[model samples]
Target: MERTSPPLRTVARAFEVIELLWELNGATLAEVTRRMDLPKSTVHDYLRTLEMVGYITRIGETYQLSYRFLTTGGRLRNRSRFFQTARPVVRRLADETGEVASIGVEEDGECVILHAMRGEKSLELGIYPGLRVPLHAHATGKVLLAHLPEAYAEETIFSDGLAAVTDHTITDVNRMKRELSAIREQGYAADWDEQILGMGTVSVPIVIEDDLVGSISVSGPTGRVEDDDYRAELLKGVREAANTIMVGYQYGH
Candidate 1:
């Protein structure tokens, strides 16, 4: 990579330490030094800088990220056009279905729940923001994958492999590929105990101007979600909600 200005190695190292802390959740100075392959004194200096900035906190010798990151993340989410615009539709879905209504987007090829509207009953199910699900294992993920360029999708899926979370999770690449194709053709995706057992989810992609912006899903216990007529009714609502969100997104754009 070419740089117009010289890159600051110290700043880069500081970020590397932050990422390492995030990955490990928390770590001791010794652990950070060993994991980062950096000198202990240098690692301590970096950790001290992060702590002084209030982005990291120290308890004894263990270093962990502070809740300040949450504030930053909240600001980012609050400013998002998609999150703000889709929230009304998400709330309606939750109110009408008594299920967990959520929006997910791909980050580092993993499905990250951006926000959710939960019905009273959905509190027990516990789908929330910051939840990460494998791309091959959930309805929201498959919807995003189906919209990705075919070769890129294939490479990502195959490289990641189908990590089965339940008996129903699809582990075969060929089957998954065919299913993704169907998701694209049908404009929706479904998951039956694919990520968490007894949970069924149905999702539709929110697209605007050929861009796969995000996916919206309704999740509930499989017994209620598996009923044919009920599934059909829920699907109709989901599609309408997705279409409305996309239309609003396009208009704003």
Candidate 2:
């Protein structure tokens, strides 16, 4: 039997301190000590070490995360071939559809938005890069789940147990599986206020050589996006954009 190794307490504590600072947006020495229930000296040492590494900064008495995280995240996003290839296509999709266009991928059993673009008529729904949402709750997520292996999809659904985000969100395992199967058959997936009330989304997978790369989607108010004519238009735009991204990624174009 394979045995799992215990996590290092020191490293875990250090990460805990960092997460605390992030959650509080910033914290003073006393605040960190109180929140973590650790010795003031130990918290100070951790803060000082992080500051030395340039991951955090101390301004007066408050210690906050630095721009280093942004820099690191930017570099990582740029390094992804999928993101690089999809950027222009997604932007064009937004422009053509006059709505919000986004690309997302599954990570850690959740869907992470890699990039999103706003069109002239786009509604501000607060979606941004790195935003993580449940895989069973949105069009991009459901499309990804449809394309992923059955075993992985089953594990994700059973383990996470489908927490609903809105009244329209699907919480039943069998029902969700049926929807995923329908998405596969239809080559697309849609959400009708599943993640946010009054919002609707249509998503198509970016598959290359039978392997799932990511998903592309367009979103807007449910009234506009779910209308028969407008929904057809948005679907065409997303499917074309997904095709373009796939070709660009595969051919280095």
For this target, which candidate reaches the highest lDDT against the unseen true structure?
A: 2
Give TM-scores for every candidate, taking all chains together and pairing residue i with residue i: 0.84, 0.95
- Alpha-carbon lDDT, every model: 0.88, 0.90
Which residue pairs come into collision in candidate 1?
none
Model 2, runs deviating above 4 Å: 1-6
Residue 201 of model 2: what lDDT?
A: 96
| Per-residue lDDT of model 2, residues 1-253, tens digit only | 2236546887878889889999999999999999999889999999999999999999999999999999998999999999999999988998888899999999868899999999999889867999999999999999999888888777756556888899899999889989998999999998879998888999999888898889999999999988999899889888888888887898885
Candidate 1 positional error at 34, Å: 6.6
Worst 10 residues of 2 by lDDT: 1-10
The clash count for each model shown is 0, 0
